[model samples]
Target: MAGLKPGAPAPQAITVHGQSRVLEIAFSDGAVFRIPFELMRVYSPSAEVKGHGPGQEVLQTGKREVGLLGLDPVGNYAVQPRFSDGHDSGIFSWDYLYHLGSQQARLWADYERRLAEAGVDRDAPMAAAGGGACGHHH
Candidate 1:
């Protein structure tokens, strides 16, 4: 079986604009993006963000002002993002990050639609969904 190769290093530039909740990343590939923190928060690759199975996803709400508290490397393939709200579970792989950078608009729009359907506001205070505030079913 063929194994996956190690991912590339993180972008050289990462700027987070707290006021706008946007996290901008400029990759070596010359791709750049300004992804909203709310968008990142909702679409976090963590199990806490992405449920174990299809249709099991828990909607993330009240995260309009979320920010990245820290970024820690997970070996050579991914980076773990620690959110200011104390969420740190997802290991964002290079591929995942690239996808987010490319599909941000669509993902964000879907997230918003889901939130609306659930009667949740992205800017309100968050309440625990699965277990603890950071617990997710993966």
Candidate 2:
């Protein structure tokens, strides 16, 4: 990973709680967080969701029940999650995960705000497959 931040706390352990729909991660710095699958899906750092530039983020919806089918290691710095919805593009780094864990509350609030602003419900269905911010159309 070219942009891996220096001295970031690496994950010492990561547990996928399918029953609770949470990812329990313990870092080398002794911080533990239970990150929700939905949050990860909504905030996926992939080009699909985040697009290629600022202001192009595609808001994700109907991901409250999304599940992690797999969490695969990417070399030594990041993890790629295979979501139940078949979204496997986001490569979450250690620092990014930490940021998500720490800022979850704020992020949720922001998501809610965006939903309200768009007049869309939190559980609204997402757009059809192949029609996303990934710069590809089918």
Q: Alpha carbon lDDT of residue 72, candidate 2?
A: 96
Q: Per-residue CA lDDT of candidate 2, range 28-116, in tens? A: 98999999999999999998888768887888999999999999999889999999999999999999999999999999999999899
- Candidate 1, 6-96: lDDT as tens digits: 4553576777777777778888778888877667777887777677767767787777767877778777666788888888898777667
RMSD of 1: 3.8
TM-score of 1: 0.79
The alpha-carbon lDDT assigned to residue 65 of candidate 1 equals 66
Q: Over the full model, what C-alpha lDDT does candidate 2 score relative to the true structure?
A: 0.91
TM-scores for the candidates: 0.79, 0.92
**Stretches of model 2 off by over 4 angstroms after superposition:** 132-138
Predictions: Cα RMSD each: 3.8, 2.1
Runs off by more than 4 Å, candidate 1 = 1-10, 18-20, 129-138
- In terms of lDDT, the poorest run of 10 residues in model 2 is 129-138
Model 2 — TM-score against the truth? 0.92
